[model samples]
Target: MEIGSSESQSECNLSIKLGMEFDSDEHAYDYYNEYASAIGFSIRKEYANKNNAQGM
Candidate 1:
């Protein structure tokens, strides 16, 4: 199943790049979730922004 914008499903860009920005975390989630679904898989948040100094 597709999971992106209503404008078009075929336009989804499954590739990721550096310095991408979204309006909100929700928008980022939607973009990634769509990419994951396109590749025949689903995504979940295991952890966010892990850093050695932060101990996350």
Candidate 2:
């Protein structure tokens, strides 16, 4: 979770900073999705494991 001024994550901003602090992208995405997603969301372990393996 390296902080940066990149357009994608915007590490200088609050959420990304907090996300990096949390150290779990899936959790952070879900937390953000609480407001961002109109419908409920799910964290699939298959996706998590694949992404974790790929360092996504």
Candidate 3:
């Protein structure tokens, strides 16, 4: 998956300069959650349907 600044990157004041690869989506989510929590941020899970191109 690609990691880049969101449209409001400036508002967040955080930047990710590295790329990460995971064996599965669950793994990625866990890693992200841990990182966010460690850095005093919160995140939520949103499911995307493969059939829904618009979601992608």
Candidate 4:
């Protein structure tokens, strides 16, 4: 996904998908952090791992 300031919603949707299931958590966070930085926002670590599957 191409993340940019003008593409906040698309970026957010991609972040949601990444949170659900992407290549890896580290990668997801990297992308999310980059996006957040570009858009002047900050995300907590707790929120980053909220979508982790717990034996489901």
Candidates in order, TM-scores: namely 0.51, 0.28, 0.52, 0.43
lDDT of 2 by residue, 1-38 (tens): 33343354432223423425446877666665542332
Q: What are the per-residue Cα lDDT tens digits for candidate 4 across 1-56?
A: 44443655554544434326659888877877876765657776763335456732
* Cα deviation of 3, candidate 4, in Å: 11
Per-residue accuracy of model 1 over 13-42 as CA lDDT, tens digit each: 565567999999989999988876765567
lDDT of 3 at 50: 70
| Shift in Å, residue 8, candidate 2 | 25
Identify the runs in model 3 with alpha carbons over 4 angstroms from their true place: 1-17, 49-56
Total clashes, candidate 4? 0
**What Cα-based lDDT does every candidate model obtain?**
0.70, 0.44, 0.62, 0.60
Clashing pairs in 3: none
Model 2 off-target regions past 4 Å?
1-20, 38-56
TM-score ranking, high to low: 3, 1, 4, 2
Worst 10 residues of 4 by lDDT: 10-19
Task: Give lDDT tens digits, candidate 3, residues 1-56.
Answer: 23433444345443444586779989877877766655556799986567565655
lDDT of 2 at 44: 37
Give the candidate number with the greatest lDDT: 1
List RMSD in Å for every model shown: 7.5, 10.1, 9.1, 8.0
Cα lDDT of candidate 2 equals 0.44
